[model samples]
Target: MSDLNARVVIIGAGHAGGTLAALLRQYGHTGPITMVGDEPIAPYQRPPLSKAWLKGEADADSLALKPLEFYAGANIDFRPSVKAVKLERSARRVHLSDGSELGYDFLVIATGARAIALPIPGADLQGVLSLRTAADAEALKAQVGPGKKLAVVGGGYIGLEVAASGRALGAEVVVLEREARLLARVACETLSTFFRDVHEQHGVTFELGASVTGFEGANGHITGVSLADGRIVPCDAAVVGVGVIPNDELAVDSGLETARGVVVDLEARTADPHVFAIGDVAHRPMPIYGRMFRMESVPNALEQAKQAACAITGRPAPAGEVPWQWSDQYDLKLQIAGYAFDVDEIVVRGDPKSGKFAVFHLKGDQLQSVEAINAPPEFMMGRQLIGNRKALDKAKLADPTVSMKEVTA
Candidate 1:
């Protein structure tokens, strides 16, 4: 079949799927493209849903990836509120929930992920929620207001952001993290301490090493949370930000390689030549890290979408950049570049107490990662250093007086 006449079907209309659809057209592919999503709304930004949008600083229209007319104008078949139930790999067809089958020459699975819910009893009670979608954010926003007591059950970026937002809305906020420190899984201890102090100064309480056995509720609504040690934390609402599980059931059911996410090559191709995956759903090999890196960030989604589009169009994948992520809490902006795992030393620049600093994670003078707190120069330079595989002098990097360019040079 000619490339122009080929049919491409994409499942999931989040950042990855939506961006791929647009890029396939932009890359001069005249094929018929269709995108299916379970949500009624079009593809929208998820990052702001937890921060600005939840705080009433941004509106729904601002969250859209593209204007509604863009899809129709581009001749892309966009199906909203539709779910792809099963994948018929052999026949190259997708069975939809609406009793329909869509035939495709190429299929892209970008199912993203779902928030992990607490398995304990009373988790299903009213006032307990997890944020993942637009509906979820709206529900959370309504529950957070003046005088409301909210307990955030996790100390990850999402949980801390929710805590900051709750404080901004005049809600009494308490963050309950089971780990010894905030962001223990993803961040260095230095950065974690900085964020904990910031949250505490904003009137948000933190309970480290606290485990919730279950929730205490009345009549269907949760009134409080019961800790493992028999202590009950009284709250009107709770937001569970434990983590996320990749939505890769379709891939697994179709007999595709699966781990925490769908296994894909560096080019985002699945085990089957015709099948591809991207975004939070694909576990692709990272040459820099020498392992499969499953990144759950917007930058990763955008990069993978472009690579998948190029691969589908018979183009070579571009050189990959260092993975990066960002978060907004209160007036502070945190930008992270590179992975900090297995670092031997951590160097801090500037002052955490002054609310401006950067943490450099190093393995024998080689830059492993950077956590920049309201420091754009550090983030930009740090990303370049990691991408170029450049090592720096620890003393120069830790000195605030030395410019980022000088340190990197």
Candidate 2:
């Protein structure tokens, strides 16, 4: 098939799928492009759902990835509120829930993920929710405001972000974390402690090492959460932000290789060559780390979108991006670069008490990762350093007086 004329069918219409469509066109692909999305509306930004959108700082239109008219103007067939039910690999066709079928030379799966529902009693209650989409944000927003109490389950970034937003909205907020410390799964203890203190300063309470037995409800609405220790934390509503499960069922049913997520090569091409998977649904290779991970972040999605688009359009592969992510809580902006693994030494640049510092995780002289709190320069420099894979002076790195340029030299 001619590269430019090959038909592309993208499933999931999310950050990765949406961007692939745009990148395909940008790279001069003139093939028929059709995008299938399960959401009722066009693809939109999800990062703000738990923060700005919940706090009324962002609107639906503002959150949209593109103006609604951009799809038709670009001559892209955008299908909304449609689910892809079955994949017929032999026929190279996709069966949709709407009783329609799409034939394609190439298929991209970007089904993303859904919030994992807390499998506990009262989880199905009206006021118990999880934020993964604009719809979820809207529902949670209505329930949080003055005179309301919001109980946030989990101590990860999402839960803490919601807690910050709830506090901003004048709701009494309490966080329940099964772990003794917050962000135990994703961050170092130093960073976790810093965030916990920040949230506490914002009038949010914490129930650490607290195992939730279930939730308490009255009239089919959550009224409180019951802890394993016979403690009942009263609240009018609750949000479970444990994590998410990737939507890889369609790929699995289609006989695709999947390990937690759809397995793919560095180019995001599945074993079936004709199919590709990106975003949260892709169990892709992290060449820099020499490992495979299913990264759930915009940067990872955008990188894979470019990878797929370039591979399809016969363009040179784009440079690998340094793994990164960010979080905004109140006035604090936390930027994390690279992964924290097998670290030998940690250098703290500046004081955490000042609320503006960077924690550098190093193995010998090589940088592994850096977590910067309200420190943009440190984040950028650290990201570049990690990508460069160069050794640096530890003493100089920890000295705030030394310029980052000099530290690298």
Candidate 3:
């Protein structure tokens, strides 16, 4: 186990895989590290695809996790545009699409997830797109311009972010959501309302309670979206941001356990001790939440990568931290820390109309989570309180005159 010359193979050169490779080297692992990915490019940041990149504020090179030379200098063999066709667990080898096999002493599955394609008709039209990769963002960007009609399906973070970006590019955006509210899955009603209003103020239209049945098009390009109510929202292009499916087929084929994602223990180890799963493709144990959950965020990927590296190098796992997520929409910055499901009470501080506020979710007096909008101080303090599971008085926490330190103390 102490041998540093062991071969470590990582599937999917994504945030998790790429980060793990760098961390392994940092932790004094002198082994041969190879990262295989289906994409032709190196690991890149995905968050900016719908925000900065689509708005033309950032370029492809800026999205990369590390410079190209970093991988070579660190002796990390990064194989791009190569699909992992099969995983031979018995031989501890991975069969790739290019008719090659890679042997490994340790394997990490960071294949990540893909955008869920709509099963509806006309989804294959030219102008219909989903944002998941660098290429996807580039394609979607071409469709955003002044006077362009862009219809966004679904009301999730991806959909909303793209809508905001489209609006910023002077495109006419209409968001179609089956639910009556925006961000219904993740945010509370108050936070959702705030975002909905903010987007509306930015001239982004929302068609709540609208279900898309199919897309309408001519000459192989999307022209409009047909709703279940027999109405069509005309658009020149459409972006589907419904959700994503974890790329766990290789794990399943290799006889590894799979649920919503590949199931992994606290140390990111899979059913096979030599194999580990991280990032969006891992349903890892969340001890604080008393359950296994998959977090699709940069912080989650980096933290899990560190854990996997430590485990591989015979080091103890890092201390647990509360899960956090953030989103950028025009001028608004939304930051959320911890899970807020099934909270007994919700408290609010600051003024949403003033473009700054924090919504605190509490199970009785215990601080469960915080959704802060342009409120950096609240986010910082709230994250600490959630990590410590500190209970605070609702009155004091909601009072702007009372400082966060006083409330936490």
> Worst ten-residue run, lDDT, model 3?
1-10
Each candidate: RMSD to true structure? Answer: 1.3, 1.0, 1.0
lDDT of candidates 1 onward, in order: 0.91, 0.93, 0.91
What is the lDDT, from 0 to 100, of the residue 24 in candidate 2?
94
The TM-score values for the models, in the order shown, are: 0.98, 0.98, 0.98
Q: Give residue 354's lDDT in candidate 3 (0 to 100).
A: 88
Output the worst ten-in-a-row residue range by lDDT, candidate 1. Answer: 1-10
Better model by TM-score: candidate 1 vs candidate 3: 3
Candidate 2: clashing pairs of residues: none
RMSD of 3: 1.0
Q: Give stretches of model 3 more than 4 Å off.
A: none
Clashes of each: 0, 0, 0
Highest-scoring model, lDDT: 2
Model 3 lDDT per residue over 247-354, tens place: 999999888999989999988999898899999999998776678888899999999999999998887789998899999998889999999866899999998898
For candidate 2, lDDT tens digit of each residue in 301-345? 999999999888989889999989999999999999999877888
Ranking of models by lDDT: 2, 3, 1
lDDT of 3: 0.91
